[model samples]
Target: MLSYALLVHAAPYSEQGALSALRFAQAAVAQGHRVSSVFFYRDGVHNASTLMAPPQDEVHLAEGWRALAQEHGTELLVCIAASLRRGLMNAEEGVRHGREAHNLEPPFVLTGLGQLVDAMQANDRVITFAP
Candidate 1:
């Protein structure tokens, strides 16, 4: 089975790119392929925001991605530069910035572009979902 890595460049709420990536990953896993990681960059960093509170009737892409990670062990990574520019921060960043809260949580890690390069190098396929 081919191992895949996904790069998402769209926000969870505003575009279909993120959703497409999620479905692609799910389908790949169902077909017995391995999805090694999903790297969220550009506006895709919004998917890692814990403050997202979509309507009950809507499909929460963040939660869906989180569930995918929990069940399939896919590494979900958010771009550090993009996340900071958009005001998304993990606990360590929050503490460093003297903020009281952080929207980034478990199952979603903030990392550098080097991680993306690694994903590209390590996986058999590197797919990008962009808006």
Candidate 2:
């Protein structure tokens, strides 16, 4: 089975790219393929914000990704630079930046771009859902 690294480049609700990545991942896993990592870059980093409280009627995109990670061990990697720029951050980052809270949580890791490179290197295929 081929391993895949997925790249998401848009906000979760602002465009279809994020959901597309999720559905594609589900399909891939069901087909017996591996999703090594889902890299959220640019506006896509918003997908990792634990603070997102969408309407009850809407699907919680972040939770969907989290559940996928929990079940399959797929890494949910968010670009630190992109996340910080958009006011999304982890616990350590919040403290470093002198903030009282953070949105980046477990299962959703705030990492540097090198991790994306590493994911690209480690996987057999890369599928990008861009804005």
TM agreement with the true structure for every prediction: 0.98, 0.97
**Model 2 ranges off by over 4 Å:** none
On residues 1-131, what C-alpha lDDT tens digit does candidate 2 reach at each position? 99999999979889988889999999999999999899999999999989889899988999999988999899999999998999999999999999999989999998999999999899999999987
Extract clashing residue pairs from model 2. none
**Ten residues in sequence with the least summed lDDT for candidate 1:** 10-19
- Per candidate, the number of residue pairs that clash is 0, 0
Q: Relative to the unseen true structure, what is the Cα RMSD of model 1?
A: 0.7
Tell me the spans in candidate 1 whose CA falls farther than 4 Å from its real position.
none
Please report the candidate that would top lDDT against the real structure: 1
- Worst 10-residue stretch by lDDT in candidate 2? 10-19
